[model samples]
Target: MSKNLSALSFRKGVEKNVFERMVDAADKAGTAEKNDIVHQMGQDHLFGDAITLGAVSFYDFLKKENEGKKVFLCNGSACLCAGTQDKLHHTLESHFKKEEIGHICCLGRCHEGGAFQYQGKNYSGQSDAAVADLVKTGKGDSEDRYAVVSHLQPAILTAEFPGIDAYYEPFKKLIANGDRDALGADLKDSGLRGRGGAGFPLHFKWASCRAASGPVKYIVCNADEGDPGAYIDKYLMEKQPHSVLLGMMVAGWYAGAETGILYIRAEYPDSITIVNEAIEDLRSAGLLGNDILGTGFNFMLKTIKGAGAYICGEETALLASIEGQRPEVRTRPPFPTIEGLFRKPTIVNNVETLANIRAILTLGGKGYAKIGTPQSTGPKLVSLDSWFVKPGIYEVAMGTPLQTIIDLAGGFKTKVKALQIGGPLGGIVPMSHVGKLTMDFESFKYGGFMKGHAGIVSIPESMPMIEYIQHLFQFTADESCGKCFPCRLGSTRGKELIAKARTDSGFKIDRELITDLLDTMEQTSLCALGGGVPLPIKNALQHFGEELKGYFAD
Candidate 1:
């Protein structure tokens, strides 16, 4: 019999496969089965029970509260703005007990509200009849729906999805030529910035990883698309899986990495299934695995379904999660490109960023660079939320005017008060500024906003500014990884302040105190989750000050 483990033996890091095993154990466990599984995992991995439990606790889906839940309603910002979660909740409660119901942050079904997950499948349009049908027949009539549009003359990211035969051509040609230098040079010349929130130059990360000293390097595709209204990654993973895979393959080839991991979120069940299928298709086509296309170069790919921790979207935290550690943000300097994923050099790119790789290689760096602005090169995917008449994903040049994209989405369904572009962490844009702003990073930054993930969650005239602020704080408080006090405690405090102001009309928020709090959270927080939440709140205070007048004291 194995002795009770007292501490972690693997100082370097746990094996990468341990995370998937833990997730599998959690998924298969019942309410009473957790302790036994935890103990077993401890024995199997030689981790202390406390450490194992701590890692397991980071993911909300692995918690005991959700053990018996039959359905999960999306409490994402888009769904909240649509005002459908309550109705969906009530309908779900009629079938499953309140204890049997749970909530997930976002389902990437922001194009339609009333999104819910049932038995590892996602469904939207949660009408009463739909809920009833779901409960009775184990399936619902409402199918997932969204439009795909491209404004570019020759669509890049939004181009028609290709089959296996066509998918491997670019990669095969790349292998035959064996011009890794040209590949890197082309990426640099193309001026491609990461489509992920940071907008860092893609080539810099690739080059850094390539130059980093390590025996084993990793290419991690961040498919944890936790941004509430952003389904761009989801669309790419589902519709253009090959493009994403090809991108990773290119990165593997260029970076001299042999393995790639696609860290897809558990909320996106369909995306997980589709991407897994796509990986198998690639493996069969001689595009993946040992001796690829009969060349000496070998590349293998696998997927890890994130266990519902939004902070795992952060690269360091994501690396930790994959290593069977707590998904807390690690301080940078020894960045992921230097020491990541088992303390080896790792290139972590988001789904959209990886998806853009094939296009860049095919078009040549200069040619691809010509598609968008000089600063923000390449096509970007914008996710217009449910408020739009034509709510879906659109591919447009980076410098396209915000108003033009809005028009492409068929405008709002109702008179909008403001728009929350990017994710929850991005700045809130007032309706008046929409026409003045452009889609590029520089433009949005100039306008005191971020084009993060380019997801537009519209706040209608009906929703109170105070309520929206509360939502922001609540989201931050819940999603915070608790590694930094500024984010962990600050988010809770911010939420409480707003809640107090909302309930007690006589209770006025001290502006100085709030400002100091925001300043601290922004200045000292370890990662963007804490640092970035203040952007939207600060934007609200600056732009929607009048709407939030009574809540604050001068």
Candidate 2:
């Protein structure tokens, strides 16, 4: 968050909700959509989730009651492309009557790395100095205005973006105070769906866990945002640790979960530190572990780091990883709800999904539901990235038109040949049909994509589309757990076929060989990875037949 412009225009939905006292979104992130993007510009880790949430709670805590305080709330997920940060400072100072404390920078690129201090401690996988800071030590000197908050994460904060303001604050208080009906009703009314890929209805999951016949029910924040190009979970854990803790606490209270576990990647060093600190903070404040906010209901949480496998992102595999086993995926005959971790009835939600719980409890579910389309009723964190016109996190409404996002990104940097919907495993949307697309689950199916992690990849003219597809296939092949036949062998075969098609001096282009390999992987792969792996390659080849002719000419 580094830019020194006079002011910045409202990004899309900001103007509409400006009047609302408590804004769910931060300066950079919009309505909460999980756009899968791995930021290469910033040397951050825990993947990316650590950045988003780290920025959130710090900002929320810094400027909650005192709107008169002009603090620069720079979200970690959004780095300064131009003058965005400076413009934000101007807006906060002029509009909110808050003291314009210096910018709360994240991503360490705050006006040419201005946010970092030589004395700062560099967390292994986190930005050098992304967390909020009020480092100016003084004896209550009123002249020192800038708080210097670091690493305000957008990932956790956006969970409540769907609801209006402190709609969640009240539910959080109620849950802390032991009001189950209010907690349940608010979460339900918030229409807060889980941010996990499964997208299960949050209220339904909570209710199911709450009503389970078992003596004990469990709530799990699937902090393993392991989808390729996703870091929202890590960001939340590191930045807004309490938001996630509070979410789990509220979920534990609502779903009757005696305990909860945050299954995150051990690789995310920043997340571990921040999460541990937040846990300690709440424990000291007596709002975590047990008797939160003086409620009779008791709850506890633990952070289990994952071994870092894509499939582990699947709830079953994640449960296995947390239990200290190999991170292999398990089937869904009895979904996590019935036979989850330790074969107990468990509810697993991604970090962004669970982040909404505290807010939903504070705000009525109805308020939350009003944020997005009827079907998808919550703000989502989309980690937007890659060779796009604009590269930043976008929080668009669930059903927002894809064109709006494309346009929002200032259009493609190069000629837009194909818009790859979803992630590497997701299919390609040829240049022809992208116009009709919308950014929700419903429209994703038409393009033969499932909106996995809301990953939108832009294909420029310079991209060797066929080679890119093959690269994805190769990555999938390498990552395969070797559990199932289709995924294990099929991905291998598919990658081979792509290689053959790309550079095989083979006298003949065995189209059937490639087609059959794709077919087998699609039909037999264990999870979406191996199964979905063949899609981009096959779809690209199918859609760009003319382009493939060059390779087959041998």
Candidate 3:
């Protein structure tokens, strides 16, 4: 390939502005060498100086010496549990260079034990031999077990997902009109809430960023789904990426912003490639870039892969990550709506939040509003884990009874002691109380649980509650950004106390002391990692107090 073609292909792999600068620097300096170009970027502060040289040198090596296609193996917790990471690493090393095969955090296919991305396609296998075959000849299962059961939902996500145009035709016409307030108002009427655990009104964020005084604005999709059981973002990004891209475009129009970023976790290498391809498709369709839909609304979307930080799932921390800073949560009040993404007004929505925008545009906010209950309107994507017979992503209406939803997954063959609704930080409900719950925002919250990611995980009766609580604290401690003492220290201390109680039979957990610690974390924590970490601990004490008697010293 010619130098221009090579550069163009490389540009397609990254942000447009970044690519333009790299190419410009190369041309102006009269050198196409990788080292010189990287030096220019560092000197110009385009790329951070700390790691630019190593990164650029590696890029140069990949461009010049790499002969085979890139294959990314999933080293996520799920994959690790299945022993895919170690097996696949040794297998790949046998035939391919270490640089040729890379590791991604998760592909969101936790159900599919061993997962890998080869040449932009995702495949899954359960053994080393299977993964090796996947990389060598592309022979692996691509089955993503998912179904949308919402009424006239226009296929939010599915395995046989048609492109965005087939699902939502009127969206193009709506965007051509370029009426920002109308678009924002439509979303407001849709009664859509953010799906990334917060459940905040999506339109409010859009309106705030639109009204914020700033010449430069940004729209970010937080695809950093760090929640333990939540793979809804991964499912959508890999299966129906165009939905997310179109959603971001709709958000850009509503917020009057030209640039958008999809901050996906590096754990999902397949999602990264799929979303980037979706961006290229949008540009090809002339739906992105300057003069979108002939409405003179210029918007461009880029994908930034995260370095597997759970804290980065928080919007403020996500913004910090995008800016090449430590992924730490920022204080609110000067929220992202007011100041974010390089001190500019920014709106950050999760993947599912952005995916809903197209539906709102096509069905009209009121029309879409009729699908679910008044409080939590619109369909929700719930990820059922391996505990269910038919485990996969299921899209259901908000007010569906919890039992009814569970039944759809073929119910449980054995006794389920408790159901962990939402993610790790979400509340735990005893099996007896499950029927009283409804799969909606208000119902979950009323039952001492939040519909965080709507990812339901079942706990078998054999699993002890004490161990579960310990595991939850361990997750929080590891993931907590350590920004606040309450979260960082409290989670660690809680985990240690639980461990001591488990190991040393004489070591008693002081209920009053634990309660005080939980209270402190709930009140003093800077963000959700700390504020919400107390939910499961408190819920366990309230419901499973009897089983936890051994941990409390008499």
Candidate 4:
């Protein structure tokens, strides 16, 4: 009976594993309170009930209240900025019971203010007809609403997007040549940094995994893109899935690994379905399974849908989630490349980083390097929020002017005072500083900002700066993994402090107290979740002090 339950827990049409049973069980039962199934999973996996529950309880989607919900509203930064979530919620309530509606962080529909999930499909709630049709007949309208274009002369990421064929040509050529060393060399020459905000060199990680001695190695693509305004990864995975898969296959070949895992967010149901289809297509084309293309190279790719934890976007937490453990941040030095998934050498690259692999190979290292600046090479994909006149994904050279990007997006729809470049952890750039910045790692870093995920969320002139700060703290508090005190406690405390000040006009926020708090979190937090949250907060305090006056005590 236990074996049957365990077997049943594994999702169909994907490789089998023990860790995913808890997610599958919770998904099937619509609640994590299935004690019998939890016990079975614990017993089969050789773990305790507490560990199983911890794993199940880590995701926001598995909450008991969210169970069996037919609608989910987007409270992401884009939606928040547009002030459409409340109206969307009210509209959804008119159609279904209030209990039937839930909330999600982001749905990669930042271009459209009203983003929601209905019956496991993403839809923009911006249109009343679309929502009415969905509520009435289950099937809504289907049209290509978002724009995806490249400003470069020769596009890299979006070149083959909206079309998925012949992406394996570079991989086939690599197999024919059998020069694995050149793969590493080209990546190094291309100077491709991680697009996932850390800006780490891609070749260094690939080389580290290649050099590590392990009988079993793994290549993981971090498709858990939790950044609220960011959907570049989603665009690539949904439209050009072959590009993502081919990149993973290339990494597997170079790093001497046979297995690859793509961890996509549960919010992105379309990405999961499309990637799964693409993997099956690869197998059919004789490009995926053992002894591929008449060569001895063997690679198998599968997808793991995230249970909706933002911290899982972090590589170590992602690894933990895949291992069926609590998705807490693990201490490093034993970096992922050294000791990763299943205690083997693992190469975890961002979705955009992996998507760039095909481009690097096709253009050659030096040729690809010539597109962007000296330090920041290759073109990058940037996502613009709904405030823009034309909000969508645009691929631009790495060092393109920030103003140029805004202009390309058709500028703001209304008067905008500031821009929140990157995600929650990124700096809050006042409109005056827009001309001083460019779209590169060094440029943003030099300007006291982070080019993280390159998703720009506009702050309207009407919204108070204090309110924005409050949102950041609240986001961090809600998403903290609770492993360390600094993040778990600090984020909550920060949110409360901001709340108190906002509610009580006479309440003066002690600058010293907040400064000390930020310093402690920045210095002592276990991971970026705790540490990086201070950046945007500090940027606000520094850049928008006049706007935030009368709230501070010091």
Candidate 5:
């Protein structure tokens, strides 16, 4: 392999503007390689990582941002749109404030790249910098767009402060509100599907759990994000953990759950410690467990270590593991709603699913529903990885085009051949189909894409198709629980077939045989891993068939 083949920087993709800016900056500095700069992004911007969902916000110190601007209350739970918009507002406030001008009427444009919203105005691509720059530099903020600065390093400046629990700075003056039920109503109206991969309607889940036939129900947060490229769940757990706690508490109250469990991946030690610490602090403060905020209802929460099996991500397997049994999946007929952990009805929501519940409880569902695509409401947070530019967990209103998602990631780092939509079991979207794609379950599933969990892994043109499939199959085969026949035996057989596909020997390989095996797995496998294990291999064989046709051409 050439030195370039091993180049991580070659995988560097970005928003064109961010790419140009970083490239120009790195060139002038001439101090480091591009990959080094890329890796250091989370540190530089104080974005801890993908799983933290949020990190320390410097907007607290920026003079312009804190001024008369209404605080949207940023946190990991609020995600990019909230964070990016706040930053844009801050930038505008900073720009306008630099001139020492008190012009609140029309503060130029939102320079940091968010659409500005007030009772009377709609400012897109307008920031305080735009207004201030117009006044001071006498020019409009010419920057066409903005992208999340991915090359920034993990920040410790805020963490260094005395005991910060939330990823953002500790805010006091607990803003008071009236009638929290109205807040829940607004969220229900917002049409916000849970940001969790299920895309299950948030309101329906809460209402169903509430109506479940039981005196004691449970609300479990599935934080075991074992996905290869997915790390958004860990982000909220470690950084803005309080948001998760608050969301869970709200979900418990709304769903009438008496107990809650956070099933975290035992592998994520950092997340475990952070979450535990926050829980301990909250307990001591009497903000949890019972009589929360003095609302007559009581709910208790506990954290359990997951066995790290992929199937454990399925709710039934999670409940079994929590019960101290081998982490194997159970059929979802009685479902969690009918027979769950300890045989009680349960509401199993994702970490991201519950993370935004607090906002809905406080803001109301209707207001929340206005954000995204029609079928899929609210902001969807996808963890962008590998081939995309500006890739990270981005929260946007539903129906945001797939191209827009890639654009947000800074476009392609390599020549785009296809995209793997939903992690291991996801669909491979072609370059031509990028524009036709929408970020929703129905649209994705109809296209043979499964939203298994919100993991977006891209495949570039230069990548070795065969090797990628081999690596992915190895993961599926190894992770199989071995309880069921098809998953266990089928995965083993699948791997063997793939190995044979790699070697021509003396005769033509049976393409039909391989396709038939894939079909059987899709139809009869026990779970998602078993079912979708054929995706990577099948896609590779179908698209790169010509390359394999010359297997004996040597």
Candidate 6:
């Protein structure tokens, strides 16, 4: 009885996996012994499920053996154009296996390409020879890079570090005044929607989490900026780490959370390093940890490095990953604000979203509101691909014309066919419609597009839209978590249909059939990746339908 009991001691009513359950059990029974017990349980069928136990032990062993054992560089569209993947292979081919020498999606360092992540730190701008030399001698130069090309007020992307006081002082003033409620109210008044793809209002998330009843709560900075062309969150984390950390700290105070986490994707090692350093600075300055700012508001900040899963960008999936579970998007009704991160009322804000908090608090909501349009207030960061003459991170007013923003990036170096205003899942707007669009939530939403991470990828007149659509479907299919059928099957089928449409002139893609699949995915999938996969495809069909007439018999 004691032996069996020792093998199973996870908390009741808590959703945890077998490994997590084993880890909790091992707190008393010892790790090695518990592992053995779990393995033996699988053979003995002591637990109700033998297959589950076997699977858990198998994965646990594999996870431990392979942790931090490989390196991957961005194979994303922006990085591919920059030739990062080839350069990575040229550098690390001899040192690592073909499996190890792999490609990743955009590291959000689109402008400063030639990027590769080793262990957990990102290195960029190194030549192939230089990367090889670094592999041999353990010395190389890699750093974060950004540019401010806009004349508008820059709240998030403005890089002038005014010391710790600059970020914390505004919130410190608010805290001292004992107006805890004002923090969220100010955010609401500012109309600062999340800079993440969804563009959900930030204040409402904070207010709900604050109002929720929980003994333990969390404020998570979702720095997992996985969108291919989007690097704003990456830029913010790398260049303005303190601002993001300070924002999380402010969120922590408002949501009544003692613990804050910066969940950064594994691709941006530079971001991870910078954010961790910023947290240490906060701790050293007595800004984090117990009794912050002599105000008795205790807060702790930690950084969790992601395993480069795109689905983990979803808040629920992120929380699941932090809890050592498979990163699958969970159903939401009990949203993250109400029940998240171990069933505690948690608020997850992206790096870009949180970066706005300190500025909002300082500027006052109304002041901040006056920066951009009424619906999409304040400054927004735009990450442009290499096709742009001056491709870099640009901060622009939210409602700025798309043409104006493109002009800021030195216009197109080539004849632009279409533009993906967001990431891959964002709309594919033809050049004809560029004049009609504005770089804001309302405008993009009205145009059946998303202002997703505000990363703009240019589609040259030379690159076929069908090929690009294929790439989108392929990416979605590859990254689908397979937790739901709609996204899982739809993305795969969509990719196959697109591939066929490209190769076989007779292979007519039934538009209605494709629409049904897309609608099913959009209406029923677990998260945005599944639902949002069809947006770009739909947009492509809308603008380029005449061009695609060659593939289908009309």
lDDT score, candidate 5: 0.55
What ranges in model 1 sit over 4 Å off?
A: 1-16, 31-33
User: How much lDDT does candidate 6 score?
Assistant: 0.74
Q: Which stretches of candidate 2 lie over 4 Å from their true place?
A: 1-172, 176-190, 507-509, 552-554
Clashing pairs in 6: 75-104
After superposing candidate 4 on the true structure, give the runs of residues whose Cα lies further than 4 Å from its correct spot: 1-14, 142-144, 161-165
> Which prediction has more favorable TM-score, 3 or 6?
6
- What lDDT score belongs to each candidate, Candidate 1 first? 0.86, 0.54, 0.72, 0.85, 0.55, 0.74
lDDT of candidate 4 over 1-554, digit per residue (tens): 32232233333213655456666766787766467876877776666677777777778776566577778888888889888888888888889887778889889888888888887888874577668877898888634378887898767788855433466776888987768787889989999999999999999999999999977788999999689999888988988888788889999999999999999999999899989998888887888888888789888998998888999999999887787777888888889898788667899998999888888888899988998899999999999988999989999999999999988888888899888888998888989999999999999999998889999899998888899999999999999999999999999999999999999988989999999999898899999889998999999999889988789996
Q: What is the lDDT of candidate 1?
A: 0.86
Ranked candidates, highest TM-score first: 1, 4, 6, 3, 2, 5
Candidate that beats the other on lDDT, 1 or 5, i.e. the better one? 1
- What alpha-carbon RMSD in Å does predicted model 5 have with respect to the real structure? 18.6
TM-score for predicted model 6 compared with the true structure: 0.86
- Candidate 2 per-residue lDDT over residues 93-209, each given as its tens digit: 443344424322232221121222111221111121222222232112111011111111333364333422243355445665556776667766676766665566777777766
TM-score, candidate number 3: 0.81
Question: How displaced is residue 153 in candidate 4, in Å?
Answer: 0.9
Q: Give the range of the ten consecutive residues with the poorest summed lDDT in model 6.
A: 5-14
Q: Model 4's lDDT to the true fold? A: 0.85
Clashes of 2: 67
**lDDT per residue (tens digit) for residues 384-451 in model 5:** 65445565566654577777777767786567676666656666666777787787877776765556
Per-candidate alpha-carbon RMSD to the true structure: 2.7, 16.5, 7.3, 3.3, 18.6, 5.3
Steric collisions counted per model: 0, 67, 2, 0, 50, 1
**lDDT, candidate 3, 346-456, per-residue tens:** 899999888877778767889989988998998888887655777677888888888888888888655778777777778888888888898888898888877788777
